[model samples]
Target chain A: MNLLLLEDADFVAADRAILRDRRLHHLQEVHRAQAGDTLRVGRLDGAMGQGELLRLDAGEAELRLTLDRPPPAKLPLTLLLALPRPKMLRRVLQTVAAMGVPRLVLLNSYRVEKSFWQTPFLEPAAIREQLVLGLEQARDTRLPEVLIEPRFKPFVEDRLPALAAGSLGLLGHPGEHPPCPRAVEGPVTLAIGPEGGWIPYEVEKLAAAGLAPVQLGERILRVETAVTALLARLF
Target chain B: MNLLLLEDADFVAADRAILRDRRLHHLQEVHRAQAGDTLRVGRLDGAMGQGELLRLDAGEAELRLTLDRPPPAKLPLTLLLALPRPKMLRRVLQTVAAMGVPRLVLLNSYRVEKSFWQTPFLEPAAIREQLVLGLEQARDTRLPEVLIEPRFKPFVEDRLPALAAGSLGLLGHPGEHPPCPRAVEGPVTLAIGPEGGWIPYEVEKLAAAGLAPVQLGERILRVETAVTALLARLF
Candidate 1:
């Protein structure tokens, strides 16, 4: 684990960071980390540092934090993603967080099932949990700010244009468009559709908001693969 | 299965291309497909088609291939992936195929364990099997081409530069750089690292070979998550 995250205020106040979380369990059970094992640590949405284990128990562990290193930078990109199935949502959140996209706009789409948005996994804590797992995997400390847009039209017509400024933007569509370019060295906002993809009207609306519709290939990728492929190519 | 894929010869004078090969087993055992059920079918390296019931035997089944439409386009992108563990290798191949990346080059890296090269999944038929699953998921027919390179330096220094031409070339690293752009358009040749990521010297080599060392964030993502994230940004 890169960042041994701590949430308990008591430990943070005592100049101590506790590994008494699910992560600690992971280290103990999966990694089998020993005391003085020097785990990489971070405070949520804060700085990154190291944690030297001092004590341990079945449920809790204590360590001292040493913030000497700066956290890695985040992507200057914001995601306008259609809410995905719960299981896929968990993976998407974790992957997005791990990749360090600073913001996410989980919007509604035509093909999206109404029930998908109601999934309990969409709750902030659950989202936070997935982000934590992603951050830990990437050895990062800062958490991306996630936003939800229950209404697609209002968000696209009213808010998206404003957010498009200084941002290289595009819409992921399996239609007529050149292939996606590599990192263009600036802020970017990308919008991806639900399972079947953005309806033509949705694509047109996003285009009006300065998001260009781009094709990945002839084959239709699953939402997850398309998301990953788009991010990787942009990188 | 959304598509039942077959070889060209498996067509012309062949049965329904019901994929009696292992796919039939997949249908019978995994999907529990019955005689009358219709399934998606495609000619390998060709367009998507459909199949219907005919006759069945202990080892084989015969049906009619009625091809009415062409498969979706193959992804113009190519993936230069560092071989992952076999367990991950299985799913990744399927996902990449589904993404419609027409070509893949799995190379060795410093972080790659020697044992991973010996995985049974490296067998040709085994790999093709995974690709088929990916095509079925996306309802596409084209099969992706996979290439394996055990040597890193020769492949990167000699073969990759020309291969990456006219393509957005990216090297995924965890360091300082501009954020990954969204909906990158154009031909793309993406390079990703092995489990522990490319060592500094290797990253430098890629940089020397015209790869732009890009960061997803401060966080280090798992290979699978990284792949997914990268694709999302690129598309």
Candidate 2:
């Protein structure tokens, strides 16, 4: 973990926290941290700063916290992803959270197998676990909001236009379309398709909803890689 | 698999190929491919074309191949990366190949765990397996050349200069350095550091060899994410 993330439940006082969970294991093993060592830390949805290890034992480690600096700014993005397969879903969640996406809409596509929606990984707790891992990896605090849309048509036809209204609406499709824009200023609403990509009809629906198609060349990248690549290029 | 990759051994004749491996299982299971089905196929380090499934059985599947199109062009870049942990190494190898990176150098760094170099994942066959998966993912037909440098100083001081000569040499570091450049028309040589980043002395050595540092803002990304982000932005 790049940053030792502390939740409210771990706090004993405003400036003191006790960690006895996996964080403690990470401290003892991965970090090989000792008492009196200082660690970079951040509170969930709060500020980031330093923590001085006060007491260390097998049961728990207490640290005096001093959270001051604000978390890093999130991307001006509202990502719409065709829910990936369960195995890929977990990694994509972590990638999205780590890359600073402010919001995510896991929408269905015609190609998205119905079984994917039944995965345990989509559970809030499971999703939050992956996001927390991402926050720890990127040293950020706030979690990105995740919205699930099982019905593609309703979400695209009813809610998408409003969500995409003021943003630079884009569809990360593969075709003879214009290249994905670079270093775009202001907000973006980007929809990325499933493995086989968006069906022609779905692309038209998204286009009608304000998201124009954009390509990233011929090579097909995995969903996680595409997410990072697109976010990096856009921001 | 987006493209059915055929090795030389898979060929029974100049135009006919038989598959009795994972590819066969994929055809039967994932693709639900049957006799008379036509699928996208690519020859190893050769051409891409359509394969007409002539026969399908539990033991084997036969395809009549007609190869024509050239694979996607590789990136005009050589990536230098500090060897990541084994699990990440596999994924990064896949990422490098999928993104069309033509060459890669897995170099030693101060922060790189010595155990990383000892991983079986570093074996040529193991590496090739991952790269092949990447090529299959992207529908590409060529594998990237991988070079390993266990010694950091000599490789950086003696060899990097010649390798970086006439190219846009850049070090993907996190600091007050200028933002990484984009859309360059020429070749590039990029060096990305390990988890904790390159130590000061290593950075200076790399600088002397021609790679100046560049930043991707404040948020720290994982090694794989950083690779994709940097490649996407630069290209």
Candidate 3:
């Protein structure tokens, strides 16, 4: 873990935190940390600073924290993605979180197999676990809000328009459309489709919802790669 | 598989080919393809075209080949990566190929774990398998050439200079260096470090080899994500 993330449960006092879970194991094995060493640390949804290790043991580690710096700024974008397969969903969650997405909508498209929705990876607790892993990887603290939309039509027609009203709504699809914009000036609402891509009717519906179609050339990238590439190109 | 890749052994005649492998199973089950159905096809390291399924059975499937179209152009870049752990190395190879990296040098770094060099994933056949999967994912034909450099100091000082001579040699390091350039016109040579990043002396040696350091903001990304992000931003 890049930053030792601290939840309220990890704290023993206002300034002292006790890590007894995986963090403790990571400190012992991966870091080979010792008492008196200072490490990067962040409080959940709070500030990031340094922690001076006061005590280290196999059972737990105690640190005196001095959280002050705010977490890194999130992207001024809301990512709407077609829910990938169970295995891919986990990685995408980590990728989205690590890339600093502030909000995400796990959407459905016609091409999304019916079985994908039944995956336990969609569970809230499971989702949170992946997001936390991402925060640890990126050394951030704030958790991105995630929304699930198993039905495509209602979410796009009823909620997306209002949610995307002030943003540069764009659809990441393969076609003869304009290339995805670079270094966009303001907020963006980007929707990416499933493996076989969005059907014609769904694209039309999304277009009516203000998300105009865009392309990233001919090579079809995997969902995770596409997410990283699109976000990198946009910002 | 987006494209049915054809090797020379698959060709039965000047205009025909046979398949009795994973591609055959994919046609039978995934595609549920029938005789006379047309599928996208590409020759290994050659042109891409459409193939008409002439016969289909559990045992074998035959196609009439008419190769003509060229594969997607590769990136005007060479990627130099500190060899990741075996699992990440496989994914990175696929990512590199899918993103159209023409060449890759899997160099060693000070922070790279010694055990990483012993992975069977580094074997030629194993590497080719991942590259083929990448080509299939991206619907490209040509394979990226991979070079292994087990010794860091000698490779950086003795050979990297000439190798990166005319390109915009850049190192993806996390520091106060200039941000990586975007949409450059010429070729590029990018070196991405291992998980914990390159040591100071290693960075110095790379600098002397003509690569200057560049940052990708404060958030640290996983090696695979960093590769995609850097490539997307540069291209």
Chain B TM-scores of the candidates = 0.88, 0.98, 0.98
A1-235 in candidate 3: lDDT tens per residue?
A: 8999999999989999999998999999999999999999999899999999999998999999999899999999999999999999999999999999999999999899999999999999999999999999999999999999999999999999999999999999998999999989999999999998999999999999999999999999999999999999999
Chain B TM, cand. 1: 0.88
- Candidate 1 residues A81-191, lDDT tens each? 999989999988877877778898999999888999899999999999998888887777778888999898999999999998888889988767988777568888999
Q: Model 2: per-residue lDDT, tens digit, B1-235? A: 8899999999999889999999999999999999999999999999999999999999999999999899999999989999999999999999999999999999999999999999999999999999999999999999999999999999998999999999999999998999998877799999999999999999999999999899998888999999999999999
Local accuracy by lDDT, each model: 0.79, 0.96, 0.95
Best by lDDT: 2
Q: Is candidate 1 or candidate 3 better by TM-score?
A: 3
Worst ten in a row by lDDT for model 3 chain B = B179-188
Query: What value does the lDDT take at residue A43 in candidate 2?
Result: 97
Clashing pairs in 2: none
Docking class of 1: acceptable
Which ten-residue region of model 2 chain B has the weakest summed lDDT? B180-189
Candidate 3 per-residue lDDT over residues B52-129, each given as its tens digit? 999999899999998999999999998999999999999999999999999999999988999999999999999999
Query: Model 2, range A142-214, lDDT digits (tens) per residue?
Result: 9999999999999999999999999999999988999999999999999999999999999999999999999
DockQ of each: 0.47, 0.90, 0.94
DockQ agreement of candidate 2 with the native complex: 0.90
Clashes of each: 37, 0, 0
